[model samples]
Target: MTVDDSLSRGIGPVAMTVLPQAAADDDERAAAHWSGQLATFGLLEAAERHFRPAAEEGDLTAVKCLVWLARQDGREREAHSWLERAAGAGDAWAMYELGVSLPRPEGLEEAQRWFRRAAEAGHALAMNDLAALLARAGRREEAKDWYLRAAEAGVTTAMNNLAIQHVLGGDRAEAGRWFERAARAGHVDAMANLGRLRLEAGEEREAASWLGAAARAGHQGAAGLLAELPGAAEAAGEAGLP
Candidate 1:
């Protein structure tokens, strides 16, 4: 199968079969699959062994695997090289990874460029991250637009961030709506934020409920806030709050 076809199918049953034959044949496609399996099992060295050969043979999937393996080994420069190679090949995830790996301050502009490319390529998380970069640069309107896109794409963090943007814009009602959506989607920060809003509005019961949920999910700030709420000690105990 072609590289693009293998990429589209991912590492499935077909890719997983006949490992011995694959190794004997030196099949780069099968090597990529084997590398993925090894990586999934936390066998980083073995994965790298397979990945290097396949990557050298021009397997973009293998190149991506090398990026992850390099990161795991704390080889940041090597990881960046692999990420750049895959991103240049039009891999959306690679572009996003490259953007995040770039050093802040000095690499901010380059990161933004990569994030925009990834987002334009339909990477939902990239949209959220790109929005955050814009927001940090004081581009509120543009940030809100990207955040809305990512939120609509079902990114829980984006939903939470979009809610924060609304809150900053003094739209409490809209903020609450988005916060609730993110909280219901299991975003811990959103639950805590929603709880705080409820507490400020004198809805102590609802605040406790949301804070308790966030606390149960291991949010220390939520646990602390929940502990301060009247009649919340028992709930905090039930949630094993720290």
Candidate 2:
């Protein structure tokens, strides 16, 4: 497949490469740190091996990692104990994870509480997630506020989501600006949205540029629109551009 075809929708689920940053002052913490490093290298089995010892010693981070691994293994119930332990220890990420682990409706109120706690602790992901929950609860204004905060905190997905909200509210100019910001940050959906917005504004050349970039960056929506872009067929036919 061509690079564009392979990435027609997304880059796919690449393993996270960022190791957790922490002061590894104890044996368990050190092991947790090492586990994170191993996971960063996609050595998940090895990372889990280290986490066993740390979790046995009651290291919350290690426990949390086990929860994630269990969830990935489709044993969602297995995550609860570790997640609850870590959350009880005041781990913000753990709290957020625990909230999401529960099924909604029955768990919605409790999840919101945990999400609020995590967001108050400055978790940008929690802020964005809580915003989603709030919006689902018919609190659009509150959700928009959190989206604004998360976007300002450099969450590109939040920027894109906020842009969509603006689009819904008929503030296309602001939506365009936010979409541009998110598109520049490598959000393919935002790139596609921006390309469509540009096309709607009668900027066919710029739309083509954005759409082409979006297609190459893994947005199928942009790829589908490529042939419809003004002068696109002419340019592609003349230059053999895919």
Candidate 3:
């Protein structure tokens, strides 16, 4: 559909800055952009109207968005079909999504296969997930390797997970460094974790700072821990903590 057709259908005018003029003129890119915005606003019918045509034309991003829309509409089978079509075309994101969507235990092997493929294609999140699967299967060394790869690729969760691996390996120094890195990147769990580590090392002020940061980020556990620190509640209230 044309841009005017999209606007006429009550999708409203999208900000030009959000979508470049060149992309607006490209049918596939326009469809993907409009479908994503529609999907975000729960306009599933309108999103599908834009997405299906692009997906049929082999736009991997559109196929991925269609999969999400299908799942949101409780059409699991349709989502899987779209995922498979995109994954078959070697789309890294589609492979990762397909891996995560598969039923656990029964589909574990298939999920790992797809995760591995996606990871090999340089999908950072896939590397993190593959590490988790390997860790579950008692492959600690391989899991650590994958986690390191993902962490280096700037996945904050991978950095957190890798820190946990270091802790398990009794390398507290390395673990603390990783936790600090992830926390600086705004990973709430890592903030809580680093706070706990600091508390254990008798660095109460540092611990409270990290814990307060995590608490303000809506981490219930961090909030609870922060409440246990002396004078923390008053400090939090003074800082307008919500």
Per-candidate Cα lDDT values, in order, are: 0.79, 0.72, 0.80
Q: What are the runs in model 1 whose C-alpha is more than 4 Å off?
A: 1-58, 69-74, 233-242
lDDT per residue as tens, model 1, 60-175: 86776676566656788998998788889888878887888788789999999999999999989999999999999999999999999999999999999999999999998899
Ranking by lDDT: 3, 1, 2
Candidate scoring better on lDDT of 1 and 3: 3
Query: What's model 3's lDDT at 220?
Result: 91
Deviation in Å, model 1, residue 42 alpha carbon: 12
Candidate 1 C-alpha error for residue 91, in Å:
1.0
For 91-144, candidate 3 gives per-residue lDDT tens digits of: 887788789989978999999999999999999999999999999898998999
Question: Would you give me the overall lDDT of model 1?
Answer: 0.79
Candidate 1 residue 96 C-alpha distance from true site, Å: 0.7
For every candidate in turn, the CA RMSD to the true structure comes to 7.8, 10.7, 5.4
Candidate 1, residue 54: the lDDT equals 79
The TM-scores, one per candidate, come to: 0.74, 0.69, 0.75
User: In what order do the candidates fall by TM-score, top score first?
Assistant: 3, 1, 2
Report the C-alpha displacement of residue 215, candidate 2, in angstroms.
Answer: 1.8
Cα lDDT tens digits for candidate 2, 1-242: 54323222222122112222231222335434544444444455544564678787888756766765555455667768777877788778777777776786798899999998888888788898899889888798899999999999999999998998888889999999999999888888988898889888997766777787778777888888877776763453344212
